[model samples]
Target: MDAYSGYNQIFMHPEDQAHTSFITDRGLYCYKVMPFGLKNAGATYQRLVNHLFAPLIGNTMEVYVDDMLVKSRTADQHIPNLSAMFTILKQYKMRLNPTKCAFGVASGKFLGFMISQRGIEANPEKIQAILDMTIPKTVKDIQSLTGRVAALTRFISKATDRCAPFFKALKGTKRNITWTAECETAFSELKEYMGRAPLLSTPEHGDILVVYLSVSASAVSSVLIRSKDNAEHPVHYVSKALQDAEVRYPDIEKLAFSLVVSARRLRPYFQAHTIHVLTNQPLRQVLQKPETSGRLVKWAIELGEFDIHYKPRPVMRGQAVADFLSEFTESQASAATQHITEPNPPLSQDQTPTKNTLDLTQPLWTLFVDGSSNAQGCGAGLVLVSPDKVALEYALRFNFQASNNEAEYEALLAGLRLAKEMDARQIQIFRDSQLVVHQVNQDFTAKDASMTAYLQHTRHLLATFHAHTIKQVPRSENSHADALARLASALEQGMGRHIHIEFLAQPSTQAPLICTIDHSPTWMDPILQFLQNQTLPANPAEARRVRHRSARYLIINGSLYKRGFSLPYLRCLTPEEGHYVLREIHEGICDPASKRLAPRQPRLLPCRRKTHFRGARHLLKLSAAKPNLQDTCRHHNGLHKVPHWNFVQSSHFHFPINKEQYLGKTKNHSPTFTVTLPELLLVTDLGIGERSAGTTPVSEA
Candidate 1:
């Protein structure tokens, strides 16, 4: 009869019990009944069958519950052994679940584990149940669904923890019964993962496969299946929410749980195969060394069963992808396209009407240019438009080692050169780099030498035009020129000049830069104040070193380092160093009026020497009376409590006295005191005193 083991209990219905009793009363031999749902029912059943089949166990067959396996070196022996088991079951009036039972079938599943003539196989149907499950709408639904598949939870690494957010939302106290965006995202991802859960291959035919198991604080186990083909697949994915106590385990310990589960579950697969295990940790390294700690030694011994190969997370991704693909079938190919949807329809003409009517009222040409540079190379390009609404494109590539600023300057130069060639005087230059435009307009000075040279060249070129204006345009608005720049750079292979030429009608002026130079004292005061407040270091050694560095940077400023010492130079120093140098510079360079206003002393903390003692004994002792000494005194109290008087009295004492005291005997001393002190004579004892004494001594004859 079909029986499912439930916890430690064996249970049988009244009908089955009556059938078994009737058969026994009829004098027919029957195997003892261990009902399903009884505590230890499976174990008790197996033990009973083990005894009944003991004589035939190794000879030809073995039975576990309703399932029987007949194994022999020869097929001849296997057939008869199988028949004998069936005959015994018939005599016991017990029936096997035909659907659940298998005989002489090369492969079958029994007791939640797959069995084959070759070896045991991991059940993939269990993983399919998780994958095929619908998105759990409510927490109760999710729990109820997950509960039904709890036996298979071990196969799902880190089962509960990965689903914790979903679980938390289900609690009676939790609000927002609807799943959150995060919960939905996690839910969808889990469903996708379940859908892609792989079928673990049988570990027979000597083919090797490795199982990588990992765990996190929130999750219990993550199992990655890898075949010797070096292709990783998911044998079964399992994870559980860590219990309160498990969460306290250190990261490595928590992670080791996956390995523990995988090792136990996949034990049958590993016994006959040599598999290289992959783990998302250095468990292998920890295991290789002799375990120094009891816990580590225990973990190591558990992991020692398999050959392990540790892989970092980055390296594990490739294997994980392979495992991901193992679940794919021909039918699921169409599902991959769900991520990419059809394109939007074209907009109606009225939605975006053309505004290309030419404006001949003011005849002017506008040029938009852009530039870019990286360590590899630099490029510049420009799109010129005529008053007739036509666009002219030009781009150039420079092979020199230049910064983005220089590339921009060159792009401006190229546009200016193009405008001059086109003989378009009173032209407007539009550029994405604000720095380049400002520097060209003389509103900002060119900071770099290369840019300065380009700026000079640009000014000289601009001089050719009767009237010219440069305006900064945002990068987004300068895409036409940007594309040309990238194209120009891509066309040129090496360090050489390359150019592109195209044509277009320019659009009307979008924005304009109005240049107004006023000789107002408002602007000069800040500049003058900044220069007057500059300072240099007082230490000649430090000053000289800074001066040498400044000399290299100051050549462009056109003055010696000492004369040109300014705030800009000090800006390069770190905050603390910059403050100190600025203070020194202000003290030395500032006018007397400014000098008086500066802080008299530099605002910096004084340096203090720290004393460190090597051992605890070298620390200072503290009295109980001092508040500052409380910690030390409190500890000392334990060490220096009052000694027990009884113990002190039991201990022996040693004391020393001077010889003169014993020898000084008074004339008034009584006979009692003399007798107590021992007899003292004028003649000295040789051993006790000097050799002049004629008295016998203890050491002398």
Candidate 2:
């Protein structure tokens, strides 16, 4: 129900009414009651409603500013829920607009969404808006279309992918777009999808939600699903178009990115319920492994807040879920249990069968690998052929430099990793590098340190499979892998191809950087715990105080931010970080005038209390003062007597350092200055280390 004249319901103080006054044609007018368009007007109304409906806000009612919703699980509870809400309104003398309020309805529009007994659904008006749109002819028209699509993105699966064409058209300066067939096809497909927008399911307490991730060449998408009664219903669909460096991420990293994006967008659902991510990818292992890529480690930490479980995805049980399942094809090697095919060509009858020869009795997947290193770049390519002849082609470009032998090992390792990911139990590996193959087969010794490391890593991976064979093949026989390696090494990005190309930022043999996270207690700790977990002090009074104070603070992305009346939300920092900021500001670069005035005006250093300049790395920027410090500097005994430090050190001011004893006043008493003006004031004497003094004026002294 909507409040009748919501802003006017709250009265303003008589003394403060003049501040809101406006002059009219005849006389000055002032608002006695809170008026619309005033800052914090909505907040005031919300606070009043919250006070009245504190007990029912989350249970039977929901409120956003003046808009209120009284929800009931069953028809029998509907009247009671409405009565509870009305009783509070009556007691507070709050009136509702009959024209804007509805009661005893099964479903109604709330906040631009159609809420019903079935579930929350896209607004009919929004769907109609997209359905009614004509082909976009201009840039503005395309933007309008994309904006509408974004509004109902949750209802559309792979929304970013579907709208990628329009985004591409918007690039560069163009008043009119070509409106190619691709855009028209995407436009029609979008309208068709919107015509039958899926009904989103709202998960209840204790209901486990499942997330399915989909990664593509240009975009990553995931759908949050709720399983009930042996069927799956979509809770939300999330998708993002990769940009800049993101486009170069490996397929596995893209999968992780999809999950991260989903978690960020659907944090409320994640916090409320346990999420089970369904995928065939080794996401859990990658995330749980201590030694992994830096970004994966960061994504894992971000998702650590939720109770998430990783499980192999099962067969598609519902149409909506099946749609997401069909969004991407999983690259898998043929099963190892297949019947043995024709045996490989036997060597001369007199020659003994070597360990590298494939056994005819057992089914083995064939792997052909090659590497290329040139002036252009370094890359590796591998083809994993299943027993049934299904080939999985993969190419990898190394972001870092590598030699020819190193790239060959990279190719072999890449093939092994692909086989592992495909669950291939037994495999036969063929490479064009005779040295690498002979080393792996123990026919050649790896004398070089890098070669030894690569051989050890290759054997470690080979141990995971049930059985494996390695042999060297001539370059002519391994042409497929050779061509792929060359393609990956020289081809510029954005050139579309069927072969999946991924960029590896570092060599496989290099160990991942180990980083330690500091979790020491900070001022935000208590507030964050209270806000996130509802934990409070044991003392009753302190608990109450914490609850009240938590209203002005909020936690976002594991960081605490404070709310304000007029200022933007500010991030709260620990004391150590705050000190660093203050020190930087105190010693940052300053104008020449500040430097010249600094030594002359020592009084500026002490305002109400003494300011210590200990461990200063930069020259102090002193504000100009009327009093000259030249008198404070005097020559005595062929040395410049600097009295400023003595005066500061002797002053009985409450500061960080101790004060010197004060002598009784004498008419002729002059300050004793034994140290020279600059020469005697060494950096070590002031406790500023030699390293810090190098950047300060004390270094000259």
Candidate 3:
């Protein structure tokens, strides 16, 4: 049942009526009833229906803005349900459009979709509109085509991949589009698919749902499926086009990303039912223990709210599901070098190989690696040759110093990473470094700590593949990789050259030291929990307060940031971290003066001064404690005065601050150390790191 003039049903308040005043031909007029096209008109009507049908919505009826759906399990309950709905409408003085309303119907259109007992389906008009569209020749036509596809994305599996050619055509020139033959082929397939679009299934209560994930070069897709009577039906289809850095994510990370995207888009389904992610990749382990990358940590936190489980996808059951799963499985298999699928017989005299089990007869990829380290610089290079004889060459320059053996390990590790990204199952490695190859092959022991770390890391990556072999080859035979390594290592500090060189900031063996505030309860704990998982305190008042405060805050990549009036967003920090930042700013700003005063000590103590915190970026002016009256400090005991020093956040250094009182309180009379206010008082709940260059920490002294 559809409400007649839904917005007009609600009368505007006497005071609000004046705000809707408009000039007419005769005189000014104001609307007594709520008017359409108002920014909050739709939302206002939705709230009214929600309040009116609070007991029936989601149980016996469903409503969105003006559209109302009255549902019953059988014909016997239909009249009673309609009676209950009509009683509420009578009490609220709401009228229904007789022409638009349909009663006692098995299936009908609701919210631009065909809804019935069978399942929700795309409207026939929408499918006809796509079928009626002609071949797009201009940019606008292609845009219209993409816009139509966007409306039916939930019904289309891997929608982004299918429409990638159309998106590519829209790029570059706006007036004229580059309509390639790929577009024509994709357009025809799309119409063919639309003609027989699968009917989506509505999951019943307590029914477990399954999600099949697919990752392509530029997009990630997943289909949510519901199984009943040994047959699978698609609940929804989701696909996202990767942008910028997302396009370069490792294949495993991309698989995890597909789940995250599904969880976000299908949040309602995830919240209501249990989700089992069907995949062969180690997505569960990667997300469960996300210490390797920051993005993984964030994705894991966001997905923690839902009950998601990982399982190896079983054999396809239904044709609708087979259509989606077949494509997903085929894409992954075809990406591997010489990958083939063969069914194994049941166990008897000869047992058949299980799924995903490696066949030794398959061709293995070849990897050639070399490293160069000299007075100029250190660098590594590798060439990965596929079974099909396609070769991929990569050069990596180390930002930090590395020994020749370490560089060789880096080269081997880089090659393994490339192979993994290409979905290679078996690999054979040949390296010019005899020590590295022998150590990896277990012929020699890695006695050095750094070498042991590198060896362990290499073994960890090697474990991902089905099988791998490492051997030492003469430098003469590995000339390609050796020359690439030299080319990258010998390049000048500042030169214009582009060969897709990658800079390794640090070795993979070393884990970065990051200060995480999520472990303990802080000012951001309540807000972070609410924003991430919708978790709130048991107390009603506390929950309300958290909800109100969360409006000004949002979590981005696992960090809490507060929206500010002056600034767009500011990262929140703990008081302990704030004190560390202030001290670092003092050291960086007054490094030269502190070294001049106490050349032997080089300690720039934080003096008494007012501090201000605001905006995403801030400049801090710190006063360095100087005993002498000169512009620069020369002594540590006579008389002290504040000096002007300014600095921005650039680097981080570790130093300890004396917490003793600084105002006229002296124990040993060694220039009374002032502790001033507490750590929390120095910076509010919102704070950031500050630093400057060239400073010797007092801890070192």
Candidate 4:
């Protein structure tokens, strides 16, 4: 019975080893001592014990290695249960450790948790370890100690904000490490609170409600428990210090994090009961629908795992005491259970406008649009702007067969094209289709070839305007467009035609086309005009082909492509134009190569001499002196007389070779000198004649 070493086998007594034939016998007569450190020791022990007492103990008694707990409700049944377990131990020759046994106790501690007949509580020894800690001298020391105690703080109340001031004082350049009155108070209060922590009732037998609250830098959470008898109690409180990055999140995001963390921390309790989350913020508004922002949407998705309803502040305070009770309350424990559950009110129409309104004062014009398709035809809708905000436009382009996304894309394209026609210098387009907006913005890649082509065309259309921007607005904010899209779909379905058109004019003398719908040859002009003005392809054949294809889409499925414009509609050009367009596309796709080829090359040339120099006065003097000496020697030794040596004069004159000699070199050889065979034969033949005894006649040739 060591705690770390589990029980699976019994050691033979030294006196009994001689009588045991476990070593020699290989049959059933021998009882082998099981190995203690085997991988299956724990499992084997549990299996063996369970099998041995299956008839007597059944499910009443459970043993895990050396630790055992026997659960029974009444004392009358304990003696028999104890006796049955003792008989098994004796039969197996297993000895029990006297000091490690506990019997007939109403509550017992095991597996790092305390369990009782009525409830569960934190181990006092674990809490005492936190209380005995000395004051920290450094930030690291304080954080380490606090982190260890924070694990047990879930059993205390107001753990986050209550301890914030103490944690804050640990920062700064002051090294004196003085504990302020607030820090000392918080520290001592935490220990005292844990010492008197209440036992939490089992969630299986109670109705649980969790209240989660969050600030910019911290999140606080608490759980309330109430039995069917209406006796309510505070089970435990938990909190966590948010990272610096988390503290900078928007108010909605912070509130979302608070609820998400609380739900996860209390999953065991909340999972067993229908839990209600009461918060000071309007979390219901966020949870009522999906979010477009990935971070918020992901957090919202995490919140969906628990069966909990979000109660807003205004509604929560009246129906539930979340705020006051969350802090410090001495009211009767039953007060929390007195409030009646109120059903959520039906949504009012007046709230719809407030929910969808955008901030129009911002520099960019925000345009919202949506599209839908049904059995009748595909329809697209767009709402450019309203007095206070941008209204979602609902345009129904009938006689088009496409998917929901295709319709959405057509609607978006129409809105963008209309914005461009309005001379909107700066545009901020909003839509609930995250896929469409993200794809167009190049934030995500197009997974399909058709989508890739359509996205490319859509981006080209967007680039025609100055300062064009696209963003994903929440579905709630894009309601106007959603409504228009639904209406268009309804119109198409009711009409049962290939083409349908409608226009909502602005409230002015001009009555400009705020919206348009058409399905006829006559409507083609306006559609063509819209495309042309938007710099969309304008070839009639191409347009007719596009219109026909788009019409076919409507006829087949009553669905238009997402962002509405078809690939052919955006690309109305002949084969030649298409070739050029393809070339341009290729160039754009290969821009990296073009960038590398743009720099100029450095200049290089062969080296050459600029000028040639003539003979100097010093060279002329040396030539004159050498000739004078040669003439004096010739006059004395009777050699040839020296001619006039005009060395200085000759140096100033330029010489030219004779024309015959200069041009003497013909195609093969120069005529300056010729060698005869007789001259060479004389030298070679003289040696041969001198060595011969007989005289030989030399032949002349």
Could you give candidate 2's per-residue lDDT for residues 577-649 as a string of tens digits?
Answer: 6544433333333221233333332222222223323212121232123122222211111232233343334
TM-score pick, better of 2 and 4: 2
The segments of candidate 4 whose C-alpha lies over 4 angstroms from its true place after superposition are 1-4, 7-66, 80-96, 112-114, 126-148, 169-178, 205-216, 299-305, 311-383, 386-701
Per-residue lDDT for 531-573 in model 4, tens only? Answer: 2232223674554444333221211112121112322312233
What tens digits encode model 3's per-residue C-alpha lDDT throughout 527-614?
A: 8786667577888567656655765565554777765555456777665555454444334454434323232221222222232222
Off by over 4 Å in 3: 326-701
Model 4 residue 588 CA deviation in Å: 36
Q: How would you order the candidates by TM-score, starting with the best?
A: 3, 2, 4, 1
Give lDDT per model, in order.
Answer: 0.52, 0.75, 0.75, 0.53
Model 1 C-alpha lDDT per residue in residues 1-701, reported as the tens digit of each score? 24233222334555656544434555864224444454566676777567666778756775666456666656677678777776765665545556555555655666677656544444667656666677666656767665745755544435565466676667654434666787677767666655643345434355656555544435555564545466555555555566787666655555566566656766765554555555434554443222223454465555544444454443544434443222212432344233222221323433321122323343578899987776545677788999888998687767555567767777787787777767575577778888887777667986766666676667766666555567777788889999887776555454354354332211111125679756434212322322233233566454334323332222112222222222233212223443344334333343222223223222211221132211112222212233433342233333322333211122352111444433443223443544543343333222211255444332211
**TM-score (C-alpha) between model 1 and the true structure:** 0.35
lDDT for model 1: 0.52
- Which residue segments of model 2 deviate by more than 4 Å? 13-30, 326-701
In model 2, what is the error at residue 82, expressed in angstroms? Answer: 1.5
